[model samples]
Target chain A: MKNIKIRRLSKEKLNKPALHRPQASIESMHKYRTDMYEGMIAETVVVRGHGGTNINAYFARPLGPGPFPGVVLIHHAPGWDEWYRETTRKFAHHGYLAVSPNIYYPFGQGAPEDVAAKVRAAGGVPDDDVVGDIAESLSYLKSLPQSNGKAGLFGTCSGGRQVFLVACRTKGFDAAVDCWGGRVVMSKQELTAKYPVAPIDYTKDLSCPLLGLFGEEDQFPTPQQVEQHEQELKKYGKTYEFHMYPKAGHGFFYYDRAAYRQEQAVDGWNKLFAFFEKYLGTTD
Target chain B: MCTGIVENAKVSGSGKGPDGWYPLDQASVSYDHPDHAQSGRAIIIDFLNEAVGPKARIAVELTPESARNLVHAILASLSRGEGEGVRAKDEPPQ
Candidate 1:
C-alpha cells in the first residue's frame, strides 16, 4: 500500500456516475475444442435476466439428451470477454450446462476494457441487480430441458462475492464456488452508501454448500479476512471447504495475465470440478 | 486487491481518445487490479469524458515506483510554471 495518495472526489463524479451496458449481440460460435473431444455445443444467446431485460449471455452444454447439472459462471471485475466464454465451455466439457450473462450490457457494447472502466466508474454493479441477474440465470438453467434441476454458481474476483450473495439471497444453486473474491469482508470505511452492507454479514444465510478458493497473499481478503469468514461460517454451522494457496494472489486463474499461477490455478480448477461433481452429480 | 474506493477529481480541457479529441471533465484515480498492466498492483488514472463514454479518455496504470516518480515530476513541472503554452492563448493545433 503506497502512502503517497490523496482522497478527493468531484461533485460531478457523485452526481453523474459511470454505467455499464449489459448488452452484446451474440456472435456465431465455432468448434474451439479439439476434435477428439466432441461432447459439447456452445453458443452465444440472450437470456431473460433481471428486470425482465434481455441480456446477452453465453451458453454451453453437453450434446447428450440426459439432463445435466447446471452452473452459472460469473465473470470478475474484468468485463465478460473470451475467458468467460471459454470457462463456460470448460464447464460444459465437464458435463454441466453453463451460462454467463453479460452483466455489463447496460453500459453498451464496447471494448471489454472500456466497458470494465465504465462499470468501475459506476462502482461495480449493484448487489441487488447482481442477485436478480444470477437468479434469472439459475431459472434459465433450470428451464433448459437438458438441465438436471440441480445447479451451482461459480465466480471469480468480485464475481466470487456475487456467488456467495446468490447462495445466501436465493435458492436453486446446489453448490457455490468463490475464487479469490475480494471485498467479501469489507472494511467499515470501504462500506459506502451505494454498497453499505458487507457480504460477510450474509454468511448465516448462505444456503448452499460453499467452496472457497483463495490466494493466501491476497490483500483484499487477506489471510486474516479468510479466517474471519471461516469463523462466521463455522459459527453458523455451514458446510464449506476453503483452499488458500501459497504464493498466489488475485486472478490466479487468469492464465493470460501475469498473476496466473499454473500449479495453483490447476489445483483450483481441480477443486472446483470436484466440488461441483460432489453436489451436482451422484458420486458413486 | 479489490482496489476498494476510487477517487475522482475535477479536470478541464480535452484528451485524445479512441474517438478523437474530446472534452475531458473528470479524472478518476485508484489503486486496483489493472486491465492490462503486468503488475499485480498499480496506481491507475482514468481521464474521462463521462458525457461521451468510457472510451472517451486516457487511462494509465503505473507501478508504485513509476507512479511516485510521476507525482514528483508533475509537482516539479507545476512549480516550474509549465502552463505557458498549455492553453497557448490563441494558438491552434500545429
Candidate 2:
C-alpha cells in the first residue's frame, strides 16, 4: 500500500478507434512466390532455455522471407494448451512471428490439465526461471530468419503477470500486453519462495511500452490494484495503455468457460492488435 | 484468482490411474481455478504418487457448495466407522 502515481486512461485515449497497422501487400502477391507457405505454419520445438536446459515450445510464423516483427505469447495458468498454440498462429498469420514456449516443460507434458495440476502441487514455477525462459524465447524469435529484430510480449492470466515481469527483468522487447494478470500486487505475508517479490516493485525497470487488458470485476487485480499499477508506471514515466472492461470478471477471455464475455474479449483483442501494431513496428 | 497456495499431507493406500494401479504417497489440496469444473473456481484435491510422475494420480474439482457437502460426507463416514478402524489398528493399547 505504499504510495505510487496512478492515472486512469482518459475517455479520449480509450475511445481512440485503432492502432496504426502496417499494410501486408504480400497477401496480394502470393502467385509470384514459391518460397512462401500458403499463410503460416506452426510446430513444436525444443529451445535452449534457462540454465542451458532445453525446453519445449510452440512456434508459429508466416511463410515468407521478409523480416516480420516477432511476438512471444505466454500461456496462461491452464498450461500451454491448444489456445496458446492457436494464439501463436493468429499472431503469425497476421504478419508477426509468434512463439509460445511451454513454461511448464520441466513438469513433463501429459494432458495440459494434468501437468497444470502437478505444477500447482509444486507451488508454481520460480520467477527467475520464468524470466530466463521468456528471455530465451524472445531470443529464439529474434533469431528467426524472418525476424525484423523487434519483438513484443503478450500473455493472459498468470502468464500476463509474467509479461510484465520479463519486460522489466530483460531487455530488447519493444512492446508488451498483459491480460487480467493476478498477484502483481501481493502483500508481504503472501510472498512465497517462487514469487519472492511483488512484480509491482519492478516497475522502474520496465524496458518497453505496455498494454494492459483487465476485467473490471476481477477480484484478484481489483480495480484498485490496476490503479496502483498505473500509478507505478506513471511514477517511472513508462509508456503504457490500460483498458478496464465493464460487466466482465476474471478469465473473461476464456471462450470455453462460463466467464467468457464475447463483446469485451473481442474489444480487448482489437486493442491488443492496435497496441502491437503500434509498438512492434509493423511493415509492408 | 491464482490463490497459489497448497496444503500437503502424507498419504497411504492407492487410487486407480491410467496405468491401472499405483501406490499413493501424498495428497495436495488447493483452492483455485479448475480445468473442468463449471464453477468459476473450486477446491481441488489431487491424490498423487510423485515417483510415478504427474499423471499417476486422481484429481477432483468441486464447487464450494459441493466441497462442503463432500467434507461432511467424509466426516460422517469416518465417524460411523471410527470404532471398527480403531479396533483393527495393530497397536499396544495403554
Docking class of predicted structure 1 = acceptable
Clashes per model (N, Cα, C within 3 A): 12, 2
lDDT tens readout by residue for model 2, A178-244:
9888888889987889899899999999999999888877876787788788878878989988777
Per-residue lDDT for B66 in model 1? 95
After superposition, which runs of candidate 2 have C-alpha atoms over 4 Å from their true positions? A1-38, B83-94
User: Scoring each candidate complex against the real one, what DockQ results?
Assistant: 0.38, 0.45
- Model 1 per-residue lDDT tens digits across residues A17-101: 2322212111111224455545678998999778998898999988877589999988888789898999999888778899999
- Worst ten in a row by lDDT for model 2 chain B: B83-92
Model 1 alpha-carbon miss at residue A200, Å: 0.6
lDDT of 1 by residue, B14-62 (tens): 8987668889888878788887898988888888877777677688999
The chain A TM-scores for the candidates, taken one by one, are 0.85, 0.88
Each candidate structure's TM-score, on Cα atoms with residue i matched to residue i, is 0.85, 0.87
Pick by lDDT: which candidate is best?
A: 2
Best by DockQ: 2
Against the reference, the lDDT scores of all candidates come to 0.78, 0.81
